[model samples]
Target: MGALEPNAALERLYRETGWTMRQLAQEINRVGTERGTPLKYQQPSVTQWLNGQLPKESARPVILEAFARRLLRPITHSEAGFPAPRRGSTPQPPTLDGLVDLGRQDMDPSRRGVLGVGLFSVALTIPGWPDAVGRMDAMRTDPKRRVGQAEIQSVKDMTDRLSDLDDDFGGRYARPMAAAFLVNTVAPYLKATASSETRKSMISAASLLCYLTGWMAVDEGAHGRAQEYYVKSLELAGASGDRMTYCHVLRGMSVQAANLGHGAPAVRLANAAAEASPDSGARMRAFMAGQQAHAYALAGEKTNALNSLREAERAVNQAESQGRRFGGFSSATLAYATAEVRHALGDPKGSVESLHDHFRLRDSTDRQRSKLIFSSLLAERQLQIGHLEAACTTWNTILDEYPAIHSGRIDGQVRRIPSLLSPYRSNPLARQIYERSRELSAK
Candidate 1:
């Protein structure tokens, strides 16, 4: 789907400069090297460019530098760029363009501030946007290459595999790779020819990948970028006419907002998810209820939080009756919500219980990164309960996994252990735990 020949602007501009394609490619590599990153563009990549190809975004600055040196003038992509599919008939050009630009922005080291901007583009969710999706037309493109179920299926399979990698390690492990996939593969595919049905299917698959990528960004502690991806994911889901997936992405955004202690926005977003959704499944309802509980708790609405928790429990019970155990609404989410609300409400003992329940849901093979967080919370709760010995014991478990969990969030958790156990410095067990934790922290 990628080798489209519409880069007329780039080809014509390069031809005007009268440099051989190989020479241009060499100059691009030299510029890239001076910029502290090695690029491997050769004659073939350049030949393909003349034949209609888009260069990688990361290669763009270097390419432009090489061109400007020959032509002796500044340039921009709009003047010397691969032409996107004409938007004259495509209903999805804007969305596809935004996503491609996002990937490109992420690739440029100097342009990183926008990606990390924590401000949610609340303007995107204006009053009529939900209904606005109805105006979109999916049957717009006519490409030389055909995209179908097979290509979309590949994306879904990749999403699943990358999800497992994210669960086991951390989001940083695959976050950039996922973004690269979106830029280098998915973007071009979206521009290819497909029927309405195929386009929606591909969009649906792409939305899932975006959501997973956002989830990893959260895991990477890049909350701003995470929200950015989630917003786009929601938009793609809406374009696909899939309310369930849209609500799912909304819920993910609510979680991050709540985690950031922005209570009002979190609650509002969660409620919006519920109101905007169609007839969601029991598990989804349960997940929503649980999310509401956490958001309310963050807002200091204890009574409302408790009621939400009760509603979530009922929803989960109903979901079990429907033979659903674990997907998005799995037990882990409920336990984590309970622990968070309990802790927020200053019920340390109950928080500890819920935290332990959450851990029980994970076996030995589960991600150690989460364990590091849950265990740290457990130890803190034990300290709050005045069980110094138990606190130290939990800290020991966290230390065991500390060396294996290479995450900034987990690092923050491990670094706070000494301060948390400071009161127990006189206790033998606490002293031993503190020394060990300090040793691990040093590593």
Candidate 2:
């Protein structure tokens, strides 16, 4: 039989039940409550219904229940307009084999790049961000040796390389490198490793790498790829049973969602991260709170955003009280996070302040030149908020630093300056910066 058309069924049901869109939504929510499945039917749901789009997976069951209740009969999937389940077909295995291959390649020493230098710099500057040896110690002390020193080293090396790529080339080059490392170096170990320590190490490394990859992907404007990497990282963290890592990955996911303009999911992911691991270290908890605040700001929930920001501050204070030094968190990391939240909240002054703070923390070493690509991003944001002089200054500084770095990633970011400063292209400072960027691009 031809499948029942959802649009036709929806029209008929609405007419027969004398239910307007609002009434139908209320009924669905009521049915969901009665059936122990709380439905969140937002305006988008109504729009989708009007456009004949199917409800999402989470809402499907609740929607079916509402239909059954309204019709005074129990409805099977077919009756509710769902397609029949295919029979006698084995389920396909997950297509993570490519990722496994890439993870292995990431482990190869030849693949390490200048970005590794930035990662090492961050580790040196940030106290809590562990190196291979530190991560190894953490794993060895664990009752399970699921994570090995070799694995830890591999992960560290990959993360460092990714950071370098980000610093040198922008995310365009960093993403492919990160994805390769995750698939080749990490996936195979994940698939075959049995020890708890090994698993934990693998999970931590994979989560961190995936997070980095997702960030790069976001920078490159590949939203779907970024989301996938974040989800994969979250899954890896869960498998390793590391709540802290899970929380971190969740926060990363929230950032991606927020960037993609999915504010609701962003808020949910951030809140879940904050709630799930309240006992985590103050730094970690603060990170989650900060993420939540950013999400709220993006959602235009000004009051909630401010509340979460305050909560983040409180967490930071608690972390400081716990004698947590600011090693694992770099001035750049903190500044970037703060700037992002401030920008979301439409506080340009605050954003600029945070960016300045980040700039203050940057290292003078050649190793850090690649990671300095973030300076360009900060300048771009400054331009957006009408801080033309500040942006011009930052852009000049970035261009000066770019020639010393051999990273394709940094080059890409520098190349973007011309376009970003196009509106002010006629301004002397802006013109100078753009010309310099153009010179670099020409190379």
Global lDDT of each model? 0.73, 0.61
- The TM-score measured for candidate 1 stands at 0.75
- Model 2, span 9-48: residue lDDT tens: 5555556666677877888888667656677676567656
The best candidate in terms of lDDT? 1
Report the C-alpha displacement of residue 311, candidate 2, in angstroms: 2.0
Q: Model 1 scores what on Cα lDDT?
A: 0.73
Q: Lowest-scoring 10 consecutive residues by lDDT in candidate 2?
A: 119-128
TM per candidate comes to: 0.75, 0.58
Instruction: Return the top candidate by TM-score.
Output: 1
The root-mean-square deviation over C-alpha atoms between each candidate and the true structure, in angstroms, is: 9.6, 17.2
**Model 2: residues >4 Å from true position, as ranges?**
1-98, 101-185, 191-208, 260-262, 328-336, 361-374, 381-387, 403-416, 419-426
Per-residue lDDT tens digits for candidate 1, residues 201-232, read 88888888888888877776777677778878
Model 2's lDDT to the true fold?
0.61
Clashes of 2: 39
